[model samples]
Target chain A: AQKVTQAQTEISVVEKEDVTLDCVYETRDTTYYLFWYKQPPSGELVFLIRRNSFDEQNEISGRYSWNFQKSTSSFNFTITASQVVDSAVYFCALTPPIYNQGGKLIFGQGTELSVKP
Target chain B: EPEVTQTPSHQVTQMGQEVILRCVPISNHLYFYWYRQILGQKVEFLVSFYNNEISEKSEIFDDQFSVERPDGSNFTLKIRSTKLEDSAMYFCASSVTGIYNEQFFGPGTRLTVL
Candidate 1:
């Protein structure tokens, strides 16, 4: 069974504030992939990042950063100096490799972020 | 930056009607997938296609759901006799390869079953 949990249902912060969205996953496969997506009012999912299981490197891309910790099975995403345009529902997803599954992605419930200007 | 494209951005159908959602994946991509999300819910995988066949499918993809790559450039999901429960936003995604390549998503088609 592969599952992703985003404990934060919703988060509210003023513009320029930093926000961290927590994500924890459970999977039996040794090899897998994790991802983060942003869905705005338009209802389209915008891919943010993808991290493989073997690489636990913390990555930063401008205002977005991701921390992948294998020991804790947690992949957290943080937005620095968030703007009102950042308001959206963020989703964490998991996908196993071909060796394990058909590479179908399973998603978390999502965290609705409200960045008020 | 290459991106996937979906057609019929919105569709409305009565219950028991058949509907086909189409997608044009990234030209170089080899893997294709379909996923849907009910309003206020998580995105759920329906099926995956590769090599002109289905690679895997979830429980949600029953006999009522089918996928096809009718042409070299188009991938489509056909829902036979759609139910009211089938109303949702369907998304199409594609990846370059199985391992390291990341999947890119399209805008999605909003299916409204009445």
Candidate 2:
């Protein structure tokens, strides 16, 4: 079974504060994919990032960063100086091996972040 | 930038009535998919379509659910009998290639079952 777990149901932070959202996954396949999506209040799924099993290098884009550690089975996301606009639900997802046509995205319960000004 | 688009931003229907949600995937993309998210719930995959056929489907995509690419550009998802549980935000996504590529999602259609 392939599963993504986001343990934090909700988190609150003041504007310009740094916050980290944790994601843990379970998968049997040696080759798989991990993803993070942001859903704003408008109710749209916005793509954040995607990482493969072989890539353990951390990634940073502007104020957002992702740390992928296969040993820990975790792909965590960090937002530096989060603003009120960052208030949204963040989801972690896992994709099956290459054979399943990019397979269905198995998603975590998602973490709702509320950044206040 | 090419983005996926969906029609009927909001739809309200009776529990027993049928409803069809429409989507237009990005041009040049070959794979299409459907997903849904209930209020305050996580997103769940419904089905994946390729070559005008279903490549995969989740357990939640039961017999009541069906997908079709009626024309060259439009893809549709039809619910035979809308149930209260079926009320959710239906999202359409497409990817140029199934593997090693990201799937782009649309604004989504909010289905409200009364």
Candidate 3:
């Protein structure tokens, strides 16, 4: 069984503050994929990032950054200088390699972030 | 950028009634999928379709659920009987290729079973 865990159910941060959302996953497969998705109040899921198992490098995209650590089985997301617009629900998900399965994503419970101005 | 689209943004049906949720994937995409999210819950994958047939399905997808691509552009999920527990937001997604490709998601349809 594969599982993703987002322990922080909710986080409140003032504008310009840096916040980190933690994600932990469990999977027996050696090759798999990890993802981060954002669901705004509009109810549509917006894809944020995808990290495969073999890559341990930290990725940064503008205000967002992801740290993938295989040793701890953790993939943490950080928002630098978070603004009010960053308020939304963030989900961390895991999936097997394409050939292993039908690309089914097993998602975390989700962390709801509230960026207050 | 071409995006996936779904119809009937919101649908309310009584228990035991049948409902069909429709989606139009990106024109060149080859894989289609259906997922659902109950209120305040994580999204769960239901099924994935490719080559005009179901390639994968979760336990949540049982005999009551069926998927079809009746036309070239349209993919549909039909629920033979609705239950109160069936109320959730259904999302349709598509990917150009299944390997290491990110799937584009639709706005989703909220189904309310009364």
* lDDT tens digits by residue: candidate 1, A4-110: 99999999999999999999999988889999999998888898998989899999999999999999999999999999999999999998754843578899999
How high a TM-score does candidate 2 get? 0.98
Better of 1 and 2 by TM-score: 2
> Poorest 10 consecutive residues of model 1 chain A by lDDT?
A96-105
**Model 3, span A17-67: residue lDDT tens:** 999999999988789999999999898999999998999999999999999
Clashing pairs in 2: none
| Candidate 3 residue spans exceeding 4 A from truth | none
All candidates: DockQ: 0.64, 0.73, 0.71
| lDDT digits (tens) for residues B1-114 of candidate 1 | 778999999999999999999999999999999999998999999998889989989999999999999999999999999999999999999988844667789999999999
Mind giving the per-residue lDDT tens digits that candidate 2 earns over B42-112?
99999999999999999999999999999999999999999999999999999888767888899999999
Give the clashing pairs for model 1.
none
Model 3 per-residue lDDT tens digits across residues B1-114: 799999999999999999999999999989899999999999999999989989999999999999999999999999999999999999999987764677889999999999
Ranking by lDDT: 2, 3, 1
lDDT of every predicted structure (CA atoms)? 0.92, 0.94, 0.94
